[model samples]
Target: MAETNSSDTRILMFPWFAFGHMTPFLHLANKLARKGYRITFAAPRKAINQLEPLNLFPDFISFHPVTVPSVTGLPPGAETASDIPISLSRFLATAIDLTIDQLKSLIKSISPKLIIFDTAHWIPQVAKPLGIKTMCFKVVSASSIALVLVPARNIPTDRPVTVEDLASPPPGYPSSSVVLRGKELQTLLFVTNPFGDGLTFHERITMSMKNSDVLAMRTCHEVEGNLCDYIGSQYQKRILLTGPVLPEESKSTLEERWGNWLARFEPGSVVFCAFGSQIILEKTQFRELVLGFELTGLPFLMAVKPPAGTTTIEEALPEGFEERVKGRGVVWGGWVQQPLMLAHPSVGCFVNHCGFGSMWESLMSDCQIVLAPHLGDQILNTKLLADELEVAVEVKREENGWIPKENLSEAIKLVMDKDSEVGKLLKENHNKWREIINPKLVNEYVDKFVQSLHEVVG
Candidate 1:
């Protein structure tokens, strides 16, 4: 392999076909592009259009549209995970796998020095022969990676891994606080089931970590140092950290309507709630969540998708719910500028699903954090925040995984109440972390990350 120039190296980013994954990859790409490295980001054509507006350094970064092959059982025109339900993600993975030849063609034409990817474990096989360095840049938390995906689990076993097997932490796992129990263990089923042509979701991620030339995560050593070290030891590979890789400050202000409405409340009084794009609550669960907000008797702005089987949020709302909360709350079934909302002076608390992106957003903001995690990684993230870090509170869940409205309301008040000792402690801890993860620290991590890429390429 020939040595590559540090100043002009072209990097290809091929994240898994999910907005959650793509958005983080773009945040890192923007960081790299700002440093003058050229980036070619590949995604489906429609996804490219959606991501175009977020391309901060378009002059240095370009979008490459890859055609997703038609696959049976996958919805027509569904190129990303968000378009279909979680059960059909395996078919989407199959669709992504079928694009290997297409990606190889792009690789040969671009001849980039390094390619960063997640979930597409085959990248190293294709890139090694072509003399390009491959990186498995995980967008998920390192705690989740260390807990489940490590090699000690002995994946590809003769029998499928049972929920019981996942209940306990793997050998030499870094933390005991991140364990899954009760109904949470059921979330690990996808790890054992086939996600792509011949591999399970666990295999996909482990293989990516095993085969890549470099391993990186969108986390910092300050928060997850021990977990990162554990992964490095298990994989016997170099590990790099990117300190949360938060999006640059937007020049555009919040949408005028949201801005004006939020201004109606006193400073640090309104509760802001939003789940990421992937979580669609059931009607019962949706009603419980909004009623929880109502029980708080505080102004709130909630942005979430409608319940399953319901076309609009209004149709799924509880009887007389909207009329009662009309002046004080709104349940919007659309996208909102979450970062801007958190930045709003009137917003005092954030109730979120604890997606990796949302995790960092909540941590960076001044709002009181309340977590309600839905997925496997998300649950682990909630543990990291609510249990390990002691910087947030998680809503208590029943044995069946249902969160009661009273529990949700109590969790919020624990952080929002003026006289609550738990709220004051959490606020103090969160402020300490926020100060540590400032811009200077993030820039340092990105600098070292770029240097590591050059070293790997050479």
Candidate 2:
């Protein structure tokens, strides 16, 4: 390793080619760049373009765009893991692995002091032999990482990890209880399988951690301190906490169309519902969610991505459903400014998919949570909040883990109905947790992380 002054220190970031992973990497890049370290951030060109709206990176940050290599059976222009259906995501992983030589060439050209790569699993090995220091940046929560760190023997090497295997508490789990169900467990297994190319996601993450010099997580001691400590002790590696890596708030306001619409509702009277970008609800599921919203008789705003291969939410809505709920509901398509939405006074409860980004963002606000976990670590995250932390309420799901239509209204009522006992508890817990999650505390952790990075490279 070479010693360099802070002004000359350069770090390259290569997160998994998805917004959920890329956004946090970008946030950290901005933070590091702001602190006077030169940054060279790299990812698929499409993924880089996605950051344009946020203007997250300073001019000091350099962008290195990697052309996504083609994969057989993958749709043209689907460069990201989120662009295609879940089954085809593995192809994107395969394509990314094929870019190792290109990445190596970039490393040679820029000669960064360190390379920060997220979850790709193959990046660290590529950088190591070239004499570059590497750090694995986990964008997910510590609990999610802890879940994957479960010993391999428990995952059944002879076969794919079963639902039951996942539901049982992994050895050394902080709790004695199971955290995932059959359906959510299945999604976790499916998403982690290196895009279903060969190695399980957990195996790749374990190997990546083993290969990297250090691990940088997007969380802090005030939130998941125990899990972070457990991971460091179990893995025998240094962990640098990035304290949520929350980007600076956007200066622009929400688009006028929805902005004016939301103003009609009283403060704390509207439900703001959104799942993260990758979740494409099935039409049947979308209809049920809408019906649930209607049953609550509450003013609501929903933003949904049409399912893959489809163009609009109208195609998924039940017949005459839009007209029926016209005055009380507004369903918009495609992405919106999420932070602004959460900050709105009219928004009281966030009905979310429990993505770690969403979870932390919601916690940072006054909004209470109504969790409907859709995939991967979301199950564990939901459990940590609703079951263990008691700050949020889980929508009741059927035995197989599907949220029935009825559970939707019931879950919302439990969180939003002020007079209800569960609702009062949920709000109380939200307020208590929010105090602990203040910006000042998180920034202190960020300062420590920057100091640690300086120690590593100075």
Candidate 3:
């Protein structure tokens, strides 16, 4: 709780309005503040409120809330990306763009030597004229970044791009070809023209990349060395590796509701499943997933919201499903303490959406993983884990990319059965990664980042 010295460097942070984006930014902010840097963290009111309870270093870190300008079609008072459907994301991006002037005013008032902004393409333009440096802080995996940034064949404007176009790699791009399939691939079409915003998602990303003075990712080279190298070489930018910028270990007590449920299971006997704040599966998809859990014959805890247009988890669940698995399964409706759940001794494997945050937490927890990636960045993240890291296995998918209950069940059983070859490898890799992604390793990266900051701004 000690105050920063008068000579402490001031840093301004602006993260895209999503829980996934904000969480990592908060982690970096706290890490920098603990090192005696004065930090100003900015986001919408909702995101700021979410960050309040997690702000461990309040003495040196301050929160600044920016009003998101309302755009037509965006739900009124929807401040972050989680509040709306994925199709409305570009509208959210446009809404964030409306706050450039307000952000510019904040920059002028604080006069920070450097600004760290995530996916906000407008920041570099505003910061340049004021002689302040800007860093584009990407919170997703480096492979995701590389995959998106890699040049691809242009689709003809006459028709919508198909899954085939996306599945194929960009000709002559550096990394091995990894592309989206099924619902994830279908979402790519909408992303191409989100809300008729003119600029595609890739275009916005490119703008942010070109405008920033440096690129900072929330992953270390040990986990993603090739992707990191490819990104830097492709962009010709100085990339700062932040060593997975993982959440600090939770020492706080768990809420009574979840704590009581977890105590019943034997050590390493439960499967912990969560798909993040934004995912909403279809009734069929949800049913298949539940059936997969049922087939495993393992006690499981799942945290998921009702799928879109549904009022409750009951509405989406198959009839008699709850009663059939009453004693062995728990379906939590809303948010729970994720880090605590993953760390629990009873949890054996994480069946997740394979978002970078969940992936890192799973790796750090020594739990094997079953990946069921949902959307953007997730497909690529799945490839990195299942294909590159060999610590996780992707759910089986049909030729058309639909995941059947049998395949999902097989994937789960494969990871949980430690006697099996794949399962043993997963546990071993998970343990090895836990050592590599230790707190000391992250601290070293932060130190390097700090040193580089002095060199860049001095």
Tens digits of lDDT, candidate 2, 134-188: 8998888788778766343256777666666666655666653325655566755
Query: CA lDDT of each candidate?
Result: 0.90, 0.79, 0.81
- Using alpha carbons, what is the TM-score of model 1? 0.97
Candidate with more favorable, higher lDDT: 2 or 3: 3
What lDDT does model 2 reach? Answer: 0.79
> Count of backbone clashes for each model?
0, 2, 0
lDDT per residue (tens digit) for residues 149-192 in model 1: 88987654787677877877788887888887788878866578
What residue pairs clash in candidate 1, if any at all?
Answer: none
Q: By descending TM-score, how would the candidates be arranged?
A: 1, 2, 3
- In order of appearance, the predictions have TM-scores of 0.97, 0.94, 0.93
lDDT per residue for candidate 3 within 288-355, as digits (tens), equals 88888888999998899887678788778888989999988977778988988887788888899988
- Find the candidate with the highest TM-score and give its number: 1
Taking every candidate in turn, the Cα RMSD to the unseen true structure, in Å, is: 2.6, 2.9, 2.4
* Model 3 residue 393 distance off true place after TM-score fit, in angstroms: 0.8
